[model samples]
Target: MSCRTVASFISLFLATTAAVQAQTELGNFSNVARGGVATTFVTDFQAIGINPANLGRNDNARVAFTIGEVGVGVGSQALTRTQLRKFIEDSGEELNMAQKQEMARTFTSDNVLNLNVDATPVAFSVVLPMVGSFAFSSRQRVTTHLGLNKNTAELLWLGKDAPIYPANFNPATAPLVSEVLEGTSIQMAAYNEYNLAYGRQVLSLPAFVLSVGAGYRYIQGVGVVDVRSKDGQLEAYSALSPQFNVDYGSVVNNPSFNLQKDTDKLLQPVGRGHGYDVGIAAEVGKKLRLGASVTDIGQMTWEGNLLTANDQKLKRLRSNGADSYEFFSELADIFASGTDSLFQYKPAQERKASLPTKFRAGAGIRVGSRLEVGADVTMPLNDVAGNIPAAFYGVALDVKPLSWIRLSTGVTSGAGYGMGIPVGFAIATKVYELGFGTRDLRGLLSDERPYASVAMGTLRFKIGTVK
Candidate 1:
């Protein structure tokens, strides 16, 4: 019943980040993560979100199925590989004076930190000669983004020890938090998605083939938090499933507290909505392909456990500072730690937000039977809670050195992320497929500016033939 409920909520996210995962757009396809190019490359059930038209492409398989495929990605502009690895190895370890200063300086920069987990519990697809291709898929996604301005970062990292705090400062006389922390925001959302799709060949010629597809998705929202401080103001809205078990402490007794407190199950959802995807693809001869798609064109309404922040001046400091780079703990301390919280909260009845909608297009080419190359561009259509902050561009190549083994690598940039080199390999046969990959190889080998990610699949197989 203490403020630790909120602390626990944030710690859960940080722990998940420390333990696991990239943009959830790549879904559970390890090959898509490796290539960083998906629009024209994914097929069958893998195309559920990327480009459904790929389902109608002339692939060798007549039936494809996969289960329990997963991907986890985590990245930070302020933490390096060494720091992240050390944090994971021994989180919350005390820091030396020099290390403290170093970390303080590092925190005083515009920072973008994120964690993404995409899991496809089950996916199946069938290619029919006259009925085109039909597919169904189920996925669970956890996506988060955190942005911090210099002043807010320094305060969160150093707490009362920050140099900006006067030696004789009094909370009663301190400047309003709104006036001090600008351009600081956090967003987290988890949801379950069920998709149905159909694709058919619309045009066929000796030299060209064109396909069109559409998809319908049912979404169950699990949790959502959208917080932002800007221009001398703060706006915070949140709705979490009872599964999170957040305790508001004495706030629950307040007249405004109407948040749902009952739970039916661990995975019970708090909101529901629907979305659609439409795509078109064309193949020129045996070597060239191009495609485009727009996805997640819908919104969700959160009616459970809705709360908004009441921005005010700082009241008290509960802790000196966080021990390590676990800023979420520090954030929890600053925002809602029992009586020491700088601000309070009130309940709301409902809220609505858009999905992470984006437009994608790409081109791919196959050379001989051993090499394929692709390029893709993704642009966000709305600045939603889960959408990427900027456009993304990538080029990837797949090399088949053996009939059953494939290697993939690519270079990707933009989307508010640094340059990354993706690498992966897969063992594929007529009836079986297994693969592992990363969106940024530097995360495994480099000490500076690494992006940690891993995507893999084992329960994958193909049956029957197109003919």
Candidate 2:
């Protein structure tokens, strides 16, 4: 692929992938403070994906709604904060031999890039005297992860100019592409989710109130891509929307190329599926709360514009080399080398993959009406593309010094990316709410690799005081 084509594809990938995180609940930035301890604290429509049981608890308002709540996060440990900034600024300076060697070494390690986004356009919920609570929500989630192994990293960083490619390289005697580039991968998915849920009080005893709830989700996928190489074997799959306008070139003549002419200007759905969420929550004397839930019990079958990669041996390095600062374009050059390249595409009919299903449970205690503390644990039920790499544990605190001002902070560990400290601020009232928060406050201050995150909302309101 030409550098221009690669650049275009990268831009589209980044723009459309503005969906959300691997943790479904984390997408609801409105409750970002309780993201680490959501089981019991999340309520109203906010609890739709986390723990529906919370909906059973009586809300202060008979009706509640929210719009324009968004969360976004992106980070990488591959390059330090300063180094990344310099690269992006692109001074147009040539790298010295020593600097190039250092970079080549730095890129050889297992480098990872994570991009996540979640936006809730609207959500509504209402409580009925004897009918319990009912809620509906529309959410968009997109997540992407890119990991580069040693060989893949070197090729992108040093290009064909790397020492490994011998002074005089020959395509006929060159090593197999699989043997050269092992342990690299890219996974991305974008989709829309609509949820309908119900929760009701099941038991009420003076000091104890127990509630059970269930939620149903309808999902429509927009695009998906999965590529990996391991043990001298490579596999790739993609089902993208026609809006991307990807050029398959002469490969269209290949029998594996299944072309469906879709002339839609709007982002069309490429796949669809459904899932269910169930939970139970209990309150003890209005001070202590406990809850547990399971979510995303389903799978997506991608068929729209499906394309799979055929394992091919490396033939030749066409381009002279990519500019050092043009990292993504270089990646495009590597992956989109047309036929006889490492990734040769053929048309596919369908591919099925599971959602990032997870189990979540937590406990919280309220100290009077101003101080609250909580702890939570989450584990993945399936090893899907969006699932956390490991179990997660967190402890958090919320302090309300004024009737309208609230502050939250927490310490978290696990979930693949080491430790983090989360913080948030909010102006909350019985009639409405507004807030902003981040999953990790330390990331913003880090000099080395830093992970940046932010979640905020301005349009949230409550109506009709519950009687």
Candidate 3:
């Protein structure tokens, strides 16, 4: 089949199986904090990803790995006593007990459904610094999403038996059914980033030391649907049909086609992209440091085909039979047959894969031989449509009470007045060093305190010391 034809089939499948695929969240900034303040020690790995100039600052060779988890929840509530009274007045009869029960369940569930997400980031990096302040490093990062459960599922399943159309069969009812069925989808996505970079000091003038560096990056993302159901038995109908169930989800046993086949086709050809990073860092005074970098100035393209299945048996059956007899057929034929094929593709539109670009600047000041304070500001340079701009500001204090002990603390602020505090400690001997830290302690406080709740912990050990 032609590419256009395949794309049309995919689009139709997505629409039909709308309830089976859930919305996915991408390009979150929270992962940035994993590098922390001590990033300067073996910081070359994170520097390539955060700020390229960072590679010039390290005097030692080291390796480090960090793992972190982030969880976010958002909800809203309103007092609608007046609106409820008006609603009752408009109804001729008082709401029965069953109606009241449903109202209570819906209100409670809606409030809980808003936005709740949990993600884990695993990262590792190795850095080697050579004579005359030159360094090379490699870093790898992966983000794993657990799952998303919007409360709408309960609401849709509860109302499934309700008449989709009253005696009038108005066109408005069709949209209402579509909206209701959209709630029953399952979505999951995973992202991986790999970077390799090299850095060297270019100038060591009397007033300052200036360094520059660059690197390449490779990124990949995949999204999958594990379960999907829409408008009661619609999915089951598609699954049992000879055309749809065999063509898609064939790897799984006893698949239920709750949505149109075109829905699955729309999500084909998972997103992939690559980009580059550049950085510069300068030491202004004996004890002062400043740096900046930009990353991910690249675009990705999505490619896939679309297929629609029409169960002719469904048109002649009722209830369960409608789901069991559905079949995969051409979109043109379905349109001609006069049965709504939510699985038809729109040939004119293309889904572009756009990644966010980021810019960051930071400064650090050393106090005597034992203490240092630093701050950084980061913002999105460019973002895709409908993507939110993320701005991050952080300040940290590092203390060396003895050659063997290092302590640090910092606060970070971001969009939406969100803020967090991180505390860390590291112990070092001649041959080995260990570190631990807690980020986003604001979680210990309430929302009224001017920040979102967040928490993170990390550990790093030195494998070998540089000469």
Candidate 4:
């Protein structure tokens, strides 16, 4: 192919691959609080998601069980818990102008909103001596992204009744406060993943040990939504919910989404695809180690509960009646309202999508007997279907004070998510282990909080005869 054709092909490949870059709920709370440090010392089943090559770290424990694993990241700086809670509590009531303005002030054309949920439903892994380590896990990864354009904010606070939208309301100069900004994007995805993996020593030397691994993943695409725009034009596609109805609004410039229905079959994944992960790790003279890996190099074909909404070029839109706080279900109805209203809701045709592939390079060093430190840089190869995640680099330290107690802490910042200090400890015995940590540990000590994250898991259990 010609060079121009190759460039076009590469662009198309990226556009497609960007749709699947998703969330952080894959590793355990320990990994979550350690600034995403799995590329270094991950020695258990968690390695399946972190670095399959770590599976080669090898242990005599032979078995591990992961339970109630959950992680949440609210990647937005516009609002806080108190504000979000207050908004929810008042969603059912009418909002006065002041309240509307307050909400609008928190939103901006450059504002980014993302919601991530990573839960491991069931997981287990085992070492088979020279046969390598084998593993499988069912995980749920969901992410939602929204870029609030100035116009959208206007629709929120001023409604379609704003004088700016009136036919004769043109002004000589753009309003200094609300200049016409570039259009924003809104995308969401939820899917269930079943991963099967194997990793073992691929090479060995007198002074170093090298391992290579690969994984096969089955993806059940539950739902996906993508609304991308440039300048002021937009186009949207949806499968985010298994099924739904959109009662599009008729108000000029005022579009509201009213999503309804679907109690029977949302869990049955609407789309299906498969992909794989491959990695390599080398331990240099027992104390220094290096590794690299690429994961989620796969695709899902969305075929069920699909919908699309092209921008309406709306001149008027519905107002404050949508956003709410007191209840969750009704709030969803208002949230999904006619935002995609003007577009005809059709049986979305099946389309192919790629997962957000990620690349990681990491290093670690063991300083003495009980203290170990590591760092890693992880970045998505392309923008995913939802929000664009920032590349991150952070360092972590793991210290063991006693055979049964381990302490870990780290700091991370990048991808516009801000900085977070993770401090946690793990208590492990020969047959059982308990681990807990928080990505926002600093929040507990000061009001100058940077991010809001929750990391906790109690059902984590492990059985081994090794110390």
RMSD of each: 2.8, 3.5, 12.5, 9.0
Cα displacement (angstroms), candidate 4, residue 92, comes to 4.5
Superposition error at 438 for model 1 (Å): 1.3
- By the lDDT metric, which is better: model 3 or model 4? 4
Clashing pairs in 1: 21-72, 21-73, 21-74, 22-73
Q: For every model in order, what is the number of clashing pairs?
A: 4, 6, 28, 30
State the lDDT of candidate 2 residue by residue for 107-135, as single tens digits. 66444666676788999999999889999
* Candidate 3 TM-score versus the reference: 0.53
Off by over 4 Å in 4: 1-24, 88-94, 109-112, 162-183, 231-233, 240-266, 318-345, 386-388, 443-450, 459-467
Better of 3 and 4 by TM-score: 4
Per-residue CA lDDT of candidate 1, range 1-467, in tens?
Answer: 24554456555665665555533347765554544688777877888988989888888379999988888777777778877667555566777656766776766544456667788889999998898999999998887777777766666666667765787888779787776767777777888999999998999999999999999999999888777777877877777777777776666776665566665666778788898999999999999999999988888888776777767885546466666755555766665534555567677777788888999999999999898899999899986677787789999988889999988889988665678888888987888888888888775677766577878888889998775
Candidate 3 positional error at 379, Å? 0.6
Cα lDDT of model 4 by residue, 1-467, tens digit: 01121112222222322332222444477787686776877766787766788777644347777776766655465656565435423436655667666666666635345556677877788887668787788887766665666655555455644444666643343332213324555566777888888888887786898988888888888666665566555555555442323232342122332232357764766678897898998898879989899988888887654555444434333444234332222213212333413233344466677788888889999888688899988887866673236687788888989978888888776655566677877886667767767665664444332345566666766676322
Considering TM-score, where higher is better, how would the candidates rank from best to worst?
1, 2, 4, 3
Instruction: Specify the poorest-scoring 10-residue window by lDDT in model 2.
Output: 16-25
Local error of candidate 4 at residue 69 (angstroms): 2.0
In candidate 3, what residue range of length 10 has the lowest lDDT sum? 317-326
How close is every model to the real structure, measured as TM-score? Answer: 0.90, 0.87, 0.53, 0.80
